[model samples]
Target: MRLNLPSVVLFALAVSLCSSPSLFGAEASADEKQADWIQLFNGKDLSGWTPKIRGHEYGENYADTFRVRDGLLVVSYDGYQPSDLMSMDKKGKKGFDKFGHLFYEDTFSHYLLRVEYRFVGEQVENGPGWAIRNNGLMLHGQDPSLMTLNQKFPVSIEVQLLGGNGKDERSTLNLCTPGTNVVLKGNLFEPHCTSSTSKTFHGDQWVTVEVEVRGSEVVRHKVGGDVVLEYSKPQLDPRDPEAKPLIVDGKILLDHGTISIQSESAPTEFRKIELLPLDDK
Candidate 1:
């Protein structure tokens, strides 16, 4: 009989996977030729991207949240109003659940993804405190087609991007796992979020973040060409209720998936989104 994993044995397996030396798979040759960068975002339109927003249909661009203006891919909240954000339902829940993601049509496995972004203007009023200047690159994500209408976030690994508040030190390119977990330094890391070593980028200055992903073997986050964080073995967290249905053959290994951008109430802009394939992957 097949057993549902939420048991102690599942926890043990996670630990065992962390200790196994085979977890560190063979590395690619240094001289491997790289392919030319493929631009995922066309500076003119959102042609190849689809919007998935909470409380809306899959293709509904709710309130025009994601748009291209001034030749930049912008996440704007200009269409939202005080009533739109504050209106409540019978359950006392907020009516306008505007969390959104703009996903590229194609999926990727082994590649180096780069994005040039910056936080701008103010966040929508009454936005969550944790989401101020907060946005993310959702990597290895579940297909938007499978997500429920009310699902707030996709099941994926988030490379969180944050802007410094002009004083306190806040690092960009941080890691956030919504329905997943990863191995860090030969141990199973189950945290919801963790910081990188990148320097704080204050104001509306542009910041470039590059993520090198090798299937499910490893993932590295870089800032200014310096690698700030490294981890491996990104798998679906069996304990996550949202991720439970995605488990197959009791296997949680994530070999590849889609990429997307977050619109978590913060106004942000992306000037470039490009990818470089590795070897033949």
Candidate 2:
């Protein structure tokens, strides 16, 4: 059969397209793939970050506790007075609880978050005992603007970061529920904190932790590129006073929220904070 001029041109164009996949949907280039990760911490400054410290206003960086130094986001206590770091007393008085959280400006969900952190120096004078070498990455957290002036922690799921004293086997990459609970082993996990199977990280060495959060469906904690803890179904705990008011329809599922890093009296430094979004809002 003889083809018309238009048909012949169409056939030739189809043949050319089939031979060149790059014109349609080729694999992403290396630079393009790297761009997928949003560098939350710019390493030079706190450009897109805010601080909320207990007993202070949302934006107040009390005593310069949270600052950028040497290209690292650092939580230092050099500016705090010794008396300002007094421990809490029996009367539930936070003379200077000073619990602070550096929250990123935006909220996220269904993403992979990675951070490189290290605990250095010493805890502030008169700092609480439990807060030594203890810092946390607060995930799915309430907005800092909503936190009370005296609230110690935000209503969020905490990826607890701990360091060893060069002796005991203090594991890192644990979980601590401030005002939320998770489902583990197909049951509602009510405990406040649970340990992960990750190895103990001692000294001032840097440790990397990657968190895979898929809304309220599931979350995973990975250390050294290996998953050590997994859970699902994060919801507000009615028993928690701080979290009760947030319950909606008798249940407030934590599918997505803000992310923050804790001060909690520990001198910590974050070198890298990055996130890879898996879906659009």
Q: Pick the TM-score winner.
A: 2
Model 1 score (lDDT):
0.90
Candidate 1 lDDT over 1-281, as tens digits, reads: 98798778899998888777689444444323334778899899998999999888899998899999989999998988787577566688764457899999999999899899999998787787888899999999998998889898999999999999899999999999999999999998999999999999999999988999998999999998899999999999999988999999998978799999999988999999999887643
> C-alpha displacement of 39 in model 1, angstroms?
0.3
Off by over 4 Å in 2: 1-32, 92-96
Model 1 ranges off by over 4 Å: 1-35, 87-97
- TM-score of each predicted structure versus truth: 0.85, 0.86
Candidate 2, residues 170-235, lDDT tens digits: the string is 888899999999999899999999999999999999998999999999999999879899999998
RMSD of each: 16.1, 5.4
Q: What's the true lDDT of residue 106 in model 1?
A: 95
Error of 2 at 121 (Å): 1.0
Native-vs-model 2 lDDT? 0.90
| Deviation in Å, model 1, residue 7 alpha carbon | 77
